[model samples]
Target chain A: MHPRRWTEFAIESLIRVLGLSSIGFVLLIFLFLLKEGLPAFLQVPPENLLGTRWYPTFDLFGTLPLILGSLLVTATAISIALPLGVATAVFVREVAPGWAREVLKPMIEVLAGIPSVVLGFFGMTVLAPLVRETLDAPTGLTAFTGGLVLAYMALPTIISVAEDALDAVPKSYRDAGLAMGATQWQTIWRVVVPAARSGILTAVMLGMGRAIGETMAVMMVTGNAARMPTTIDSLFRPVRTMTATIAAEMGEVARGSTHYHVLFGIGIILFVITFVLNLVAAGAIFKKRRRGGLR
Target chain B: MRPKIRVDHLSFYYGDKQALFDISMEIRERQITALIGPSGCGKSTFLRCLNRMNDTIPGTRLEGRVLLDGQDVYAPGTDVVDLRRRVGMVFQRPNPFPQSIFDNVAFGPRVLGLCRGRDELEEVVERSLRDVRLWDEVKDNLKQDALSLSLGQQQRLCIARVIAVQPEVILMDEPCSALDPIVTLGIEELMKRLREQYTIVIVTHNMQQAARVSDWTGFFWLGRLVEMGPTGDVFTRPQQKLTEDYITGRAG
Candidate 1:
């Protein structure tokens, strides 16, 4: 074989290996998680594992409160972020003048690049006290405070993705709407936004994925109480998340103990949730492409 | 017949470059007026000028007057939305909102608040679809996504969407350019039928289409009107040398 052919073969093999290695790594992580975490599910009684308490020293290990805490904080974050992000995206994409759009887009991208730890620090210092005073809650660090921080962290993702979706709508749709006597607002709401619905929904799902997987900001502000958030008022009360529990206890946990395995169990659960969210987001994007291609 | 729209020394500029030179013409009420020209000869730009659609583009400037029903549409404080409602437009390609067929047609009436209630809105949608002769074909599938329709049907739906607002004039900019010959014939036939109620101004690259459908035809060359007259005379006995050359395939 020629030397050129040998070099080509080497490059192709190297590329294939690099591509396959990511899948290999993901599978290895899943297998490792299952091997360590599966024992907790089997050894611990189902009632104990699924109970309300998460007292590790006393071997309680119920993940119900942690799971609920994560859901409450993430749901609050999304509820706050979705509307604000989508509105900002519309303003930037459809309403802003060219120079303003050029300036605003880069600023939003810069916002997304801010470290999550810094946001967490800000939440710990500024947002928690504000929430505590505003709501007159007993403590500042609560699910609501955590949600506010997460919402800010997730805003840039939602805005940029939704803006791209709105931008992808064909220019002809706007012309048609305007030609029919619709005002700019009417055209955007009735035609352009509706046309980009699936893409916008995908953006929301991806933002939710980012918010749910986030650890640092949530852990800092959510006053790790490990209590069930059963009442509506629990939104303003201290709660611990699955992620915070794993992060906080992993350092002192005895190796291969059931408590350590339970933490791994929480990791598996988080991975599954974000994986499903990304799948749904992908599905929405696929649907948008199919509809877009039809014309 | 009185002119529904009158253009007096109209000129348009996009930023530093002028697009349309001083061009003047009359669009008679309930008549089909076609502008035939080569690509980039300013026919579409002139058509957009009638309804002030050019205002949507950034850094574009228009001088001279476009009067609709003897009212200057470009005058200060002229309600652009109202002017566009009076004069609707169809584009080169069919552009339906990514929605159901019913919603696509009803969009205009809903936005303009022309209908009193759901029943009236439904009546308007049905009437508009019938006007475009698309009711029978799409009535069974009004709930289906508009994108699911064939290109010809989508174009017809776009026409339905425009007429649902009940405009006094319809401006078509190469409305059939994206269509097949058969589909183009269908649209042309619709334009003729539409002329009974609304004044129509069409810009077409196909001289044969202008000859077939328009009562009054204007020939544009290089941003200027070379000739304007009855379609028969313009096609058969064009007075200007440029018009004659263009009609005889001698020069663009």
Candidate 2:
């Protein structure tokens, strides 16, 4: 081969290796988790593994409360985030003046740069006390507190992604709407939003994932209670998530102990949930693009 | 001929940059008036001014008066949304919304609340589609996506979309520039058919297209109206040296 051709081939091969190594690392991690986690499932019978109570010290290892806790927090965070984030995105991309947009875009990026630990500290110090005093609850630390903090955390992701989607809609669509005598708001709602539907869905899914996998902030504010929520007003009640369980208990447990293996098992479950969320998002995007291309 | 729309000493500016100098013209009712010029000579700008489409752009200003039926369209508190409904526009490129064919045509009427019932809306949609001569081909596939149509069909659909609102006048900005020669001819035929009911003003870079379809023609050069008259008189009878030179292919 010519010298330039040989150089190109070598560079291409190196790039491919670098690109594939991350996927390889993920597979290795999954295999290792399975090795550690599957043993705990064998030691703890199926009934105990799937039980509602989760007293790990007394040999009860049901994770239903933790799973439900994560679901409730994530769903509440998304409900709060989706409308606020999408509306802010529309304001930034479509309604704001040039200077306001310039200022807001970077300000939102700065919000993303805030550390999770600092956010956890803020939630513990600021939001918890406010929640307790305002609602006149026994304690400030509750699922609602965790959810509010998580919603704030997820806003940056949703706003930026949804703004990009809104921006991607063609200029002609707006003009067509306006020339048809539609008001500016009507045009934005009827034309621009629908055109960017797939992208907005992606934003919501990503925001949900961020809220679901969050550990430190949720743990700091949720009071780490490991019991089933008995009341309809359980959002104001203390709860603990699977992620928090792993983070709080993993370091002190003896190596190769059932507790250690159980932490790994929780890790596997978290990984599987995130994986399924991503797969569902990818499938929806794929279907949308295929239908879009068919025309 | 009685003038349907009149422009008196109009000028336009986009952020301190003058795009149109003093211009005046009369557009007759149920007649086609063609504005012909080279690229960036302000023919399209003048066309957009007719319906205040330029108001959408930031930092743009209009001077002088534009009267529709002797009522100043640019007067204070003149309703822009209502003005657009009366004076509809078709863009250079075919821009159909990503929606069903039936929905695309029905969008204007539905949004403006023009029809009282579903049957009335369906009739308006069918009539508009038939007016554009597209109903025969697309009648069975009304539920299909509008983007699934050919480019020619999309342009016709856009025209039908405009027609559904029942505007008194239509502004077309180089409406056929994106289509092929055969499709352009078909659009020209449609334009002639549409002229029987609606007053039409078209801006085109193609002088041949202007001469072929227009009853009255105006030549614009460097934001200024050089000459305008009956198409035959402007093309055959030599008047202004610049106008004659432009028609003879000596100047633009």
Candidate 3:
């Protein structure tokens, strides 16, 4: 082969290897997690494992509370983030003037780049006390506080993706709407938004994925109580997420103990939830593409 | 008969660049007027000015008067939404919203609040679809996605969308440029039928199309109106050297 041809062959092979290795790494991680976590499911009694208590020192390993905790916090975060994020995206993409859009786009990106730990710190110092006083809750750190922090964390991802979706709508659609005597607001609401619906749904799913997987801010503001949240008022009470439980106890527990394995089990569960979320998001985008390539 | 639309000394500018110079013409009521010229000759720009569609673009400025029913459309305090409803438009490409055919045709009525209820809206949608001769092919699938239709059907749906608003004047900016020859002829036939009720203005690069369909033909060159007369006179009798050369394939 010519020297240039040989170089090209080497680069192509290198890229292919690098691409395949990431998938290989993911499979290896899943296998390792199963090896470490599967024993907890098998060795522990089914009743005990599915119970609400999670006192590892007492040999009780109920994960219902942690699972429900994660659900409540993530649901709250998404409920708060979805409307605000989508509205901000609409303002930036459709309504904002040129200079304001230029300024706001980078500002949103910067919001995303702010360290999650720093946001956790801010939540710990400022938001918790505010929530405690406003609601007269037993503690400042609660599921609601954690949800507010995570909502902020998820905002940038939602806004950017939704903005891209709205931007992808063809300009000709706008022309058709305007020429039909629809007002500007009417056109956006009736025509442009409905066309971009799937893409926007994908954005919400991805943002939910981000919020559910987030650990640091959630750990800081949730007060780590590990109790089932059954009542509506539980939103204002302390809770421990699966992620926070895994992060907080992993260092002190013995390496081969059931507690350690249960923590890995929690990791497995978190992985599955986020994986499903991403799959749904990807499915939405794929459906959009198959329906005439996003118009 | 009095003209349906009259353009008086119109000039247009996009940012710092002028796109159309002082151009004037009359669009007769219930007749077809075609503007023909090479690309970028301001024919489409002139068409857009009829309904103030150019206002959507930033830094686009228009000077002069466009009168619809003896009222200046560009006059301050004029309701632009109502003006556009009075003078509907079709674009160069078939652009249907990613929605159902029923919803696409019903969009104008829904937004303008022209229909009192769903039944009335359905009636308007059916009437508009029948006007564009698209009802039989799509009536069974009015709930289907508009983008799923063939190119010709989509174009007709776009026309139905415009007609649902019940505009008196329809401005078509090269409406047949994107279709096959047979589809083009079909659309031309539709235009001819549409002329009995609506004043139609079309912009086309095909000089033969202008000769065949237009009652009045206006030739634009370098942002200026080169000639304006009856289509028969403009195509057959040589008055301006530019119009003659353009029609005869000598100069565009």
Candidate 4:
């Protein structure tokens, strides 16, 4: 009670510093993007968004191809990651024995720790070449290849977080089901699965964010050409992606030129897409806050 | 009367450490059998072993014979799933599924594939709920989540879930430990009524509860059955000194 003034002062200043710094950093990045990227929208002729062409050298920079490619690769990656990740999570949390769990858990954590560049290389050496030979296509770098790489790349985040979610389910629920003659699988599907639904959703959205924002991996595996993502059933074909386009173009463009602004614009678009996903992921997390998993 | 369940030379071990020592007992049909003792007496352990609930734990081993109506429950070919279907269990805490009250009751019937149609499932749910005396209260709100119910009501719902599959044996491990006095009495009355149709085995720490409910009572001490007889006789004149001391408050 006697030191109320000092305690209050210390607490207030510490919180203010942390809170303000977070907001300040966010504001600085957005302001930079706005200043450098806003002019592209106000060009003498507004760029066509739904078109499939991007010709910056001839004073024409339409982002439709890059946007489509990014969307295609991200969607493909998510479709692959969702099932594999959730299944791995279920096996690890529910079915795996103690020794296997002890061995596998660290293995998954190690997967998470593996640098994205190495995974990119794996796609180049193993996945992409395999895709090329299987599909009999010209090149391995394609939207499908990027998705496959990103799936293995984002595996740990989805599985680890979702496993934690499944593990959070109260033991009483499982026991009650088991006591009522529900088999192990039934208990998981009917009780544990439903209870961990919100968490799984959160994990999916988080994994989506991880896959979509990935630059180096997608850039390496996906053939970096500013072209439309052509229809291909297999991953063994070349496809251009938005992040790759921006990263490729940003280095060569002169400062304050229209091409540079277009790259900045692509950066802004990428940022916004991930921003929206983060908002969705954050909302899912908020809804799941009280569910506080298993026992 | 013939015994519904007979345990002969039953011993339980967690790996090498023994928990139950040379326990033998007979449970009659349609009667409440209370296993009563202080903590660490293996009373709860013995109750769980009856339904093979202990099998869920890792590194646990059991020896000897547990017979349900002359069939060896621990036989090499005995299907644990089918065995569990006939022997129901209720834990100490009220463990209602996160789903609706209706789904909770329907869980067992659905998993066991006992009912074919929605109408038949509804009948089982209704009958089970009525048996537990929870039908009228939750009949209209059956679609509502189970967690919405009060603690006592949730416990009853758990009972309904067990009874839906129509198990002949019911094993309760300190079923009322988490309930208040009023709820416990409600449960006690339910158990009294249930015993007329199903064999009921309950493990309780409360001495007076065993006297009030059980027809046959077994007193366990440290990992052995100290005494077993009619509840009235055990309460009035326990044969073993340890049982008498425990009943008379001389020692645990």
RMSD of each: 1.3, 2.4, 1.6, 3.0
DockQ scores for all predicted structures: 0.76, 0.60, 0.78, 0.51
Top candidate on DockQ is 3
Candidate 1 residue A14 C-alpha distance from true site, Å:
1.9
Ranked by lDDT, top first: 3, 1, 2, 4
**Cα lDDT for residue B8, candidate 1:** 97
**Candidate 4 vs. truth: CA RMSD?**
3.0
lDDT (Cα, tens digit) per residue for candidate 4, span A101-152: 7898889978988888888988888988888888778888888899998888
Say which docking band candidate 2 falls in: medium
lDDT of 2 at A208: 92
lDDT of 3 by residue, B1-252 (tens): 899999999999999999999998889999999999999999999999999999989899999999998999999999999999999999999999998999999999999999998899999999999988999999999999899999999999999999999999999999998999999999999999999999999999998899889999999999999999999999999599998998899996
Location of the lowest summed lDDT over 10 successive residues in candidate 1 chain B? B140-149
True contacts kept of each: 0.82, 0.58, 0.82, 0.60
**Model 1 CA deviation exceeding 4 Å by range:** A291-295
Expressed as tens digits, the lDDT of each residue in B30-85 for candidate 1 is 99999998999999999999989889999999889998889999999999999999
DockQ of 1: 0.76
Model 4 stretches astray by more than 4 angstroms: A1-23, A44-47, A227-237, A288-295
Comparing 1 and 4 on DockQ, the stronger one: 1
Model 4 chain B worst lDDT window (10 residues): B77-86
Model 4's i-RMS, to one decimal, reads: 2.4
Question: Interface root mean square deviation for model 2, in Å?
Answer: 1.4
Model 1 residue B161 lDDT? 94
Clashes of 2: 0
TM-score of chain B only, all predictions? 0.99, 0.98, 0.98, 0.98
